[model samples]
Target chain A: DAGITQSPRHKVTETGTPVTLRCHQTENHRYMYWYRQDPGHGLRLIHYSYGVKDTDKGEVSDGYSVSRSKTEDFLLTLESATSSQTSVYFCAVLRGAYGYTFGSGTRLTVV
Target chain B: TQLLEQSPQFLSIQEGENLTVYCNSSSVFSSLQWYRQEPGEGPVLLVTVVTGGEVKKLKRLTFQFGDARKDSSLHITAAQPGDTGLYLCAGDGNAGNMLTFGGGTRLMVKP
Candidate 1:
């Protein structure tokens, strides 16, 4: 709670609408990631930022994009929301030795 | 292709029973981590294994990393209702910033 915070804990939107989920971290970790959880697919990585303005795609990066203008903030944007994108989105910051700290997730529902 | 596959996607057991969750991968990792996530919240780190053939324990839960560093496992002894949740395994294959997660194993310990 003190280290990281995710905005818009729950949201409902229609298809084709654009949506953005924000993750603000207090600890200045250099790496941040966005992942979506589905029933059988597990947690699939969408995008990740290694540092300010440096982003890379993960296995499931087709419909998502990420931006990190500052070391403490990373945002995930869905250009066109779809029903398939309706799932829990999680933000994680990486520390040394591959240790990660996760923020409370945001549940997005796209109709 | 999914690198990590978790076994027993869902498990329902009684209190005091023991359960083991596996996270297997073909790629070797620099480190492995176990997390427990409750609904509506983020996954919390339980333990991390960095060395090959390493084992770490937290109370009734035990975590182990494969000798080749390509897999990991978590064993919960004397399960309780509080232990019920979605268990996740994550790792960094080559010492990078982000992690690859397993499909996740959901366990329910009945009272």
Candidate 2:
């Protein structure tokens, strides 16, 4: 889908540790987003980037931060991992009006 | 605080049965999209309805958007086991260049 890729497909980290998830795209789409999927809660947006160096917070951005230093890369960092943050995180690139193209996602576990 | 709500959070049916998933919202959207997600993978876009009252069909799946552009539905006819996955509806927010997703409906079509 859109040549979007996510790194560290799976990871287990201790609580209070910092973890960063990477999303890279080959299509050079200007908009990228990070979301976490949890059972019963659905997918909640953490943050999104409109362009290099431009970013904004989404509904569930409290525990997450994002950086888009380059057009092809968007990074999502969990400052301090918590049990509640253990979930599958997805990276999506908006292909204009056609909608989003998502990466396979990264599953994170905090213990 | 969820802008969009999906009914019947979970559904299980036998193959050949028909099922419809509903996504309702109080606010209007520029477009609505349907996605299917399998276990351990990111969601894949199935269809997008842009106009109010617009209806689109793909194979045995049908998607409909409300006349008010505030709701949408996906109906699957003659369901198959391969159709099992999480179904999500997203509304194009048209504000932040992002989408608002509904709590997905998990569907399982048993053979």
Candidate 3:
């Protein structure tokens, strides 16, 4: 919460549109993650970055893409957002043995 | 498939009540972490328990890692209205590389 920040707290877009969410951190942590929370599904990892320009897909990486061109920023992009993609997205930074610190989250709705 | 399963999806209790929420998984983890999330915000880390049969206390929250390393529990003593939030348990399934989360337990502590 102290170092991580997510932009555009809330957004509403039409189906088939492209959307991007940004997560910025001041802690300079190497591991940054993107997760989506849905009812009955809890939170599922979409993607994560271990370092600048180093990324990997998570359990639910179907229609999502991510980029971490710098250590302080990680971006999650949905090429073609669907109604089912409407949910809360959270950004997290792993702080080694201390666990993770999460951003405030971005709420997205697709109609 | 959901790797972690949380029981008692929802819990409502009066102030000063005690409650326990559980997280179970068939797969063993290197570590387990607990988080509390409030409305419109992402989850914040509460505690991280490594090692089997480990127990950690944070104020009124007591977290226990199962002896088998396949489960964990959170017991809240004298839960107050301030404790009303979604409690989530996550496992580091990849030996601290990635986390697999459980369906959260939503607690409502009415005053």
Candidate 4:
């Protein structure tokens, strides 16, 4: 639970549509990460932010983007959704004092 | 390329059975983490082992980091249906504070 919440627990849309998924945390952590979980591929990092205005691409950052303008919120955008982009997305924050805290998750289905 | 490798891409065991999931790698890490993720949910942090050869136990689940700091293993005793999930291992050893995750092992404990 870790004070983290992800918007739109589930979504289904057609291809080429614009979509945005948000992750908000009550805990002002320094680091936030976005990951996608899939069969066989496990979890692949999409984008992560170390601080406000500081973000970097991860192992699988091609079709997605993210922004962190404030300390407690992070937003992930799919500029043009595609079928391959269908997966479960998760946001996480590094608690510093303990293990990583994860959001519930957003299951997006692009058809 | 991927640094971490996990064995037994999928596993199924009856309740009360014992099982082990492993993560192996050639690159050494400062610490490694184990997580369990259920469908439509984010991966929950199960354990974190900092020092090499460290072993931590929580109830029936035991996690062990290799002495070389390049591998880890998770053992579940008397497995229960509640333990069924996708188990993942992540290695942390970079300044980015990012983790390299394994392909993951999906476990199904039948009651």
Error of 3 at A50 (Å): 0.7
Ranking by DockQ: 3, 2, 1, 4
After superposing all C-alphas onto the true structure, candidate 4 shows an RMSD in angstroms of 1.3
Q: By summed lDDT, which 10 consecutive residues of candidate 3 chain B come out lowest?
A: B92-101
Off by over 4 Å in 3: none
lDDT of each: 0.88, 0.93, 0.92, 0.90
- Candidate 3 versus the native: TM-score? 0.96
The sequence of per-residue lDDT tens digits that candidate 1 reaches over residues A1-111 is 338899889999999999999999997889888988888877888888889999998888998888999999999999999999999998988876547888888999999
Among these predictions, the greatest TM-score belongs to: 2
lDDT by residue (tens digit), candidate 2, A59-96: 89998899999999999999999999999999999997
Question: What ranking of all candidate models by lDDT puts the best one first?
Answer: 2, 3, 4, 1
Residue A96 shift from truth in candidate 1, angstroms: 2.4
Name the weakest run of 10 consecutive residues (lDDT summed) in model 1 chain A. Answer: A94-103
Q: Give the clashing residue pairs of candidate 3, or none.
A: none
True-vs-predicted CA distance for residue A70, candidate 2, Å? 0.7
True contacts kept of each: 0.88, 0.84, 0.94, 0.78
Model 2: pairs clashing at backbone N, Cα or C within 3 Å: none
**Which one wins on DockQ?**
3
Error of 3 at A19 (Å): 1.0
lDDT per residue for candidate 3 within B49-103, as digits (tens), equals 9989999999999999999999999999999999999999999976438889999
Regions of model 2 farther than 4 Å from truth: none
